[model samples]
Target: MLVRQCKSNFLGWIVPLLLLSITVHTAALAQCSPGAIICETFGTGTRGQLPQGQTNFSYRAIPCPNDGEYNVMDTVASSCHGDAWHRVTEDHTAGDVRGNMFVVNASYQPSEFFSQKAEGLCPGVTYEFSMWVMNINKVLQPGPCDEFSLRNPIIAMRIEQTDGTLIREVVQPAVPRTTTPVWVQLTMQFAIQTNVNDVVVKLINKGLGGCGNDLAIDDIGFRPVHPTLTIQFPNSTATETTVCADTRLTLSVGAATGYPNPVYSWQQSQDNVNWTAVPGSGQATYTINPVRAGRTYYRLRNAQPINANAVGRSQCSAESNVLIVNGRPDAPFSIGDDLALCEGTSQVLRAPEPLPAGTTIQWSDQSTNRQLTVDAPGNYWLETNLNGCTYRDTINVAIQNCHLEDIYVPDAFSPNSDTVNDKLVVMHPGTFTAYSFRVYDRWGSVLFVSKQADTHWDGTFQGQPCLQGVYAWTVDYSVLNGQNQERHFARSGRVLLVR
Candidate 1:
């Protein structure tokens, strides 16, 4: 294999440099990777309102908050010693006033300071949850709260459902006490394994307060992180090459680690726009047979399943760069090319219409005909005997599945959290080559978007519960046609979001 496997090093800064928007620290979230969307920026200002419905603590308009209370603030206040403590002057967002950040004093017991629910999210995708936080407590020499006695800031972040079904969790254990404020980012990436479209996030403070358990946070975001894939040739980094006909070549694929389990499929194409999968070519390495005299393209496709036990889909899949192989034949003769066909479909291969007298033709199948209809994929040769001379030509007929399929959707669903039709699921046979689903409000606001055929809607938008009414849904998908071709389809309908 020419390509080396990409690995994730959570302990190093390189991973963040590759996957996160912030490269200043060991941030793990897919911060600014492609398709990343910020769920919350808090707000912008020297001091902004404490985010409503996002945190459980009481909002106090003070630079320093009391136990079970928090406020978004800028600037600072004197410490217990009446002296200015190690305080942050601004927020975490760059180029802006560092503006304001979440300032909190640890509660007596564990409590969630931030809670949010996101719905209509796509399925089978690896999403990264991240936030910038800092331990704002300062240790003054000859002070009451010594390093040994002061408790460090600690917190737990998790994703769950309304029914309290735990999906995943990441614990900071403890944010080390610092003399000066240092903003660091913490991130966690995981896959959505089920059809449930509602994902709830909670950040709980577990530190005990009295002296030195204080923290500030900013730039909380959630986004998708897909593996980077590449194809390589042995002893070469070139993506395109010219070789003689009948030349054998070996290619390998490599991808970054993070996704649960990813499926690999090798594809071939004459024009880069249209691709056809090579039958049984689902491995890290693929061997190309003797090249035919023509220009051909090859690439790798990667699809990660929702979890280890699930099948992968193309909606959130990754495609590799194309590798062009131009074949130069020692003996050049043009037999032309056969147009691709759908599986179980037919194509007629006709010989020259104005044939010379005394001309006879025999196909590879031993059938004598001027034209033959092929329904399957393989090589077909035609031998023409005319003027006491014979000529032979071959054609490789491509056949694949390109059938358009539909998804089953209900006219309405109840999201009362009663677990009975609580979501509107876009049901399909799970065989689509590509798929996308979306739900929209009457005013043209998008409520949900799904990448998998089995995704659903939880009747919520932006952490706010939606009212009972009719909502529109649209679906676009592609299925296998003959010759591994993709047959595209689209559908739309209205459904009631009953409370």
Candidate 2:
């Protein structure tokens, strides 16, 4: 049974004798939330149709267990919604004990045979059929009487009218049984009419001959099909397009339509298959914000319009163009490189794209020096006001800001239990590849050493606490500056280890 949004909370009905046209308002549809459990169980006796059976039709009653395991089977036999049937014990033999119903391997197959006997039958109504089968396990292996040979066993159902005419017959797929002697259920569905009073529901095993394996059956019902709407976007093919990088793109739906007023949403996927909705894309004609400069595909999704109070499933549309962005210039242009003097100086800027022969070129940094002085840190770039089209490129410049940067220390300290800045710490910030710090007492005795400068001495030497006094410190280091050039420095100093 299909689920749809209705004005009321619960709508349960047996289909009427008239085939009524259903009108779906797109505005009343909504997306079904995750993890919803829906069940449509037509009552017993209204299930399973009558296939073309030449002989007897029978049903048996069964016993309910008291193990208190009120799970699917337990609850089904005992609860209000528990409409499942049990096996009849009175028809059991020595091997087929009481409370066991068996379906033998006769002419049982899937979707092949059907029976119809219409003494009371109708049109335009819906019906449901359910059956119970259990293993008697009377015999051992595969034979004419063994249910295990019941390969591809299916049930075929049909409804016949008074004039020997076939009204409706539903052939359901067959089920395979295991060696375990448990009960299994089969269900079938059909649409019927109201004038039908003495309509027949047939249960025939297709494929398996009359002497097929054995199982039992019971309880059927007739119920109504729920209100649902399905929509599709016709003749739409996924396409790909190429555009320049970082360019905003607009995608349009091509040759597609929906039943309900369709709401549009846009989704993107880098790879052609997996797609996700773009943020803030809950409207039609979506605009890509700061469009990415790459080959990205987008899809258009259509949703069923939702009414203020309706809640149901929303249908989806197909994907759209795969757009690409291309950059300009086609290749990287070069500018002439020149060196500056005085150690920390910088060279004037130049544009690789040729300029007028007499144009005055200004050095970047606003310095009139067509050349930069060797002193500080900064970046350089150039621009020329030619042809009204501004062309520019920037080269980064860095200066050595930290120079007296070698390790230094004080020589005396008092560890007489007073607190102040009392430890020797090697400190500097930026990137470092490797470094070592060493501290020596008056006699040139190595008191502490560390590869990591952050590790400071708290008046401790070689696991034993040392007395606070004067300490000599020395450090060696190498640095890679912002330009990725390496330099080395070594320095010695005195540190007052105070306490």
Candidate 3:
């Protein structure tokens, strides 16, 4: 038995090579490579049914139909394609196209075809279409030998524009005649001619029928030869930095090259792992108004690529670095609403202690010190600036007056032992610090004197009752002014002494 494989170069020439029987047998177990944008393995759905996202080509042979025009089959039948058909499973290169494989036969005409439409392809972008195929022949009644003469079959793969114009076409090496079928892997690389956004990929089995046009293909894949997509911050420092609360931050994406026109979206995350899209952030630049504190992570996500083959989505997306922001502290101090001071005294107003570092204190008088002294009263305030934020508090102050006329003294007292009118006293409206009262007789001699404010004068001289007559009295006292300063007060008045 002879086995051959073919490869096409950039110029579209088929280069054939020979393989030993042992090498051909070992090739049945080959697996599909990774990185395909679309891989139709036909692993889903029941046998004899069409796979999802695919349909049979309109062209079909009318004469010798044995089953549905297009069907998926399992590797349970011995005479279906070849003994090696079961080895060609979906991802595995060997083992009957993994679970189920696509099948088409040319029972009436010399060929049969199946096609599917592919959308969102980049114009003039090179893509590789790959699949595995095997020839099927009828088995005799007593054994797995062919009932008719053995024949080789050819498989052609083509990409056509929506209008059915061919863009590129390549035929796989013919499947050689053998008692047991052998699976061959085929790949064709092509680019769309014009700006075609949609194209049809068709796989056709071109071979003579009688009993030899049956073909089983599996593990189809379509992908770009080179996939490119990238996202980065224009300013490297913006990746990991800090910001102030309510500050607006603008983040822009770095220039991306090689990828087709790509769509962008901005996202934010607190943990840097789970991300959510920021509304209205679908442009190349995004802005943030951080009204709160704590750390936030941001990244630019490549949402859709002009070339569908490019990779940039959720886990595979390009992300920016992290940002940490801080908010302003609360008002630090409480200045009482009202403050009082004497007319001639000064009072010092102090700011709250243990102030935060980098704090700036300003007074209503434009003083930068943390303490201010005021004598004249009106309104005073203090403003503190910390971490780029400001807070203020105000106080009202009033001045008080102290006068001598505010004190009153009684003019007369009787020493007759009656409870009423038995003592001489001085009365004042305000608080006094010191007070003294003195009484004199008609002969101009001092009779009684008291040093305490609450003490009173009784009508007596040297332990003898003085005659009841007019007596002279003098009183002195001191009171605190508005500024807490003391002022002296004195007065003299005549009083009548009665028995």
lDDT (C-alpha) at residue 367 in model 1: 93
TM-score of each: 0.45, 0.28, 0.42
Model 2: per-residue Cα lDDT over 1-499, one tens digit each: 2243221111122221223221212121111122112222221222222222423433212232221111111112212112122223332112222222222324323322223333322233234433344432232346554355633345555555545556655455554444433444554445555355455444455545433333443222233332232221223333444443333555555544332465556667777667676877765466664456456666555533432112112212222334332221111223444333334554444445445543334446654334434344455655443333233445555544344344445465554445654555566655556778887889999888888867766677877777656677778878775467777788887766555
Model 3 weakest 10-residue run by lDDT: 1-10
Q: Runs in model 3 with CA error above 4 Å?
A: 1-37, 51-70, 79-98, 105-110, 119-128, 132-153, 174-194, 209-214, 223-227, 232-256, 260-499
> Candidate 1: lDDT over CA atoms?
0.66
Candidate 3 residue lDDT tens string, 207-249: 5554455667666655554434333444664445554544466
lDDT of 1 by residue, 1-499 (tens): 0111111101101101112233235322332334434434445554445445867778888766777777766555655325535645556655444455678877776778777666655566666756677777775443464335667677876667757888766567577655566777766666665576666767787777666667877666555566677887777789888776665788887443323357677888998978888877777788887776689999876776443222232335666778888876433233468656876779888776565566678888899977788888889887766444456779898865453475689999999889999988877653888889899999978989989766778888887889999999889888874456778899999998877
- Model 3, residue 17: displacement in angstroms? 24
Candidate 3 positional error at 96, Å: 12
lDDT of each: 0.66, 0.42, 0.58
What lDDT is obtained when candidate 2 is compared to the true structure? Answer: 0.42
